[model samples]
Target: MIDAANTYEALFVPALFQQWAPMVADAAKIESGDRVLDIACGTGVLAREAARRTGRSDRVAALDPNAGMLAVARSLAPGIDWQDGAAEALPFPDRSFDVVVCQFGLMFFSDRDKAVREMLRVMVPGGRCAVAVWDAIENAPAFAALVGLLDHVAGRPAGDALRAPFALGERQVLATLFKGAGANSINLTTCKGAARFSNMREFVEAELRGWLPVMGVVLPEPQIDRILAEAETILARYVTADGLAFDISAHLATCRRP
Candidate 1:
């Protein structure tokens, strides 16, 4: 496992989080004066959103195991209270937050159950804990196509395998995870967004410099370049009257502790 200290910002910051904000905010239900905690708050995307809703009276605490990501978070969203901590072992005391949110971070945890339990432990009674994860490859055709084309062209291990944990989009698993963590009610919902690129080049550029770094473990430089060329070809099909439109889908799970 790569140290959390090293791999967050470049791997997950702008790329993964650009699609997560809306999903998390909708599921977490940020309200005025609500004290919230954003676990794995990569660059403080969710934290900033929550803080905006909470205003000055209340606070939004953003926590992450990655010091690099936390540095970016502090710079990007200074109003948020940024802290260094892991999801499985949160630093806060029990019942510290009215809402605890983890966006795209739950899947990376080594101990998913313990992380869920820790999230609940920090939430006040009746408070909410919400998590967002990516759907399976088939459900996200754009990403699926990208991965397929990349692996085919590069003749390398698929990058999507590294992202397997986030594919747990089933409602049953979401419910069970929360219930086992002492939550009384669980709600699951899906959010879909469109990412428009002028052409395949821009799309490839975004992926290459963005979350593509995360796949470096599986995709080397030569392989990534080959994949990019193939990705451009496949994405050309999606370019129509407007532009290249790729669908981004996420599963949002919200649970309320008894």
Candidate 2:
């Protein structure tokens, strides 16, 4: 899993996550020497960037629920403090960080309300936080197509894993989530980017082995080829000899603690 994370950072980071991290960091106004915490920081992508912008004073920290992910995070970016934690019960003390950023992680928390409250609880008064959630699977065609193919071949469990992250896709749902947590001046914006891969096969391999959410689904050997065949055909239109590119959409919400 640690090795898988390395590949994930190399391959999927640019294709899926790299753009959003900076957007979140900028929105939160991360400055040099500012203490930053990245909640659910799988592999510390955002934390690492924030650390770069904040200089090498070790003011950056990352936390995640998975030990494997934390191990990978610690190895790749040892400068930041990496801790094992969940969003609903962050391990840090109250009002500890100047800014908090979560990229595509809030939807996976079991108790999102408590998780939002926890985000607020762990930040300094009026601290900024930026979060990005998939707008909708349908809005992101490649992922949606892959998920549909997986459901048809691998069953609903496989598809659900892919769909789960977009559970908070609705803007109102996200707004209410922050508002109910007493967040002030909440502003939600649509962030559009391209989910790029070298090819359809690259996309398949990454999703099967590198993507944390759908990584663990055990498929029969026969079904692996079956699913791939279908996905390739379904995704062919987006593919070129050079690679594949698909428009992806997500909601980036930024707010200040009340």
Candidate 3:
């Protein structure tokens, strides 16, 4: 069986998450010497980008609750200080970082209000924070189709797992979360991005093998195969000469600590 985190880094990172790393970093306005913290760092795509832009790996720290994800992140970027932790309760001194970023992670936090509060709590008085979350399932036609496919083949749980990432898509919901956490000068922007996979099979497998299990909705191989077969026709509109491609969007929220 393929490791989920490894598959995520291999498939989802380049296809989905990588494009947002620089955008989130830019929203945070990371400078060469700025201390950065990446909450729910996953495979550390944003953390790695922050390290690259900041030009000081020692100044970059990333935290995630998953050991498997952290292990993959550490292997890929050893210079980063990878920690096992959750976003609701950050393991750091108050006002420790100059910039804080959470890319596509706000939706999964058990206590999003607390997590947002923790993000602001760890930043200096004037520190900046940027968070990225999928805009909405309906906004991305490819994923909307995938969700429909999962609902038909894998059941509601599997479809819901795929839908979970877009839970905070609304601009007001995102802005309110940070404001409730006492964040100041909140700014929200809708950033356009795209998801591309080698083919329909790879696109379906990335979610089946890499994402569903993490959400606790693993299907049998036969069911997975069935889904893949259906995906080719269901998601056919996204197929191109190069691969499966479609437009995707996310809301990026930037804020500051008073």
Candidate 4:
């Protein structure tokens, strides 16, 4: 799990979806006084944004099993209650929060069913639970183009290291997980955003600094070199009037525990 997390912290956390604070805040639908729990709140992206949206940090609890990631979250949002734990084994008592959220973290849990049940256990009856994951890379054109190029240039080994949360995009599987967790009413929404860079250099830096960990896991060094070369080619496709564009497709899933 730590291996998975190292890759996430490296490849995605900083440059990929960090700017989705507004999206997270908007989706949170937090009341000023609502007690919220952010399970597996990696680096506090959603937790800090949710705190801002809720108008106070005190009402939000950020939980994660990774201390390094939690440390980063704590630095940005000191007032938030940061706890070291996993989604399957929460420290809080039953029905403790008015809202529960997990973003981009559901796909990695060792036991998805147990984790969802734990999330349900901590939520106040009728409270909301929200989870977000990336759409399949195949459906995300900008990313897919880069992936293709990498496979062409970097070879297969480098491309394989970049894989993370591979199962997240399957809607049928996701629906079953929610149903099994006892969330009978589920709402699914899709969000589209873009990651913009001024040039290939900028894009490479963003990915290297932000996504290298995941990339390392999926693609071997030779493949990474090839992938980076392909990334340059893909960047050419998105050269707009101003800069390069990398569009993102994300899934927003919300459910109610009745």
Error of 3 at 38 (Å): 0.1
In terms of lDDT, the best-performing candidate is 3
Q: Write the per-residue lDDT of candidate 3 for residues 71-92, one digit (tens) a residue.
A: 9999999999999999998999
Cα lDDT of all candidates, in order?
0.72, 0.85, 0.92, 0.73
Error of 1 at 239 (Å): 2.1
Ranking by lDDT: 3, 2, 4, 1
Candidate 2 lDDT tens digits, 157-228: 888878887888899999999999999889999988888887887788777667734347656668878877
What is candidate 2's CA lDDT for residue 122?
88
Q: How many residue pairs clash in each candidate?
A: 0, 0, 0, 16
lDDT of 4 by residue, 12-115 (tens): 55556676656655665777888999987877878887787778899999998876677667777799999999888999999999889888788778899999
- Runs in model 2 deviating more than 4 A are 212-215
Better of 1 and 2 by lDDT: 2
Q: lDDT (0-100) at residue 168 of candidate 1?
A: 73
TM agreement with the true structure for every prediction: 0.84, 0.95, 0.98, 0.83
State the local distance difference test value for candidate 4.
0.73
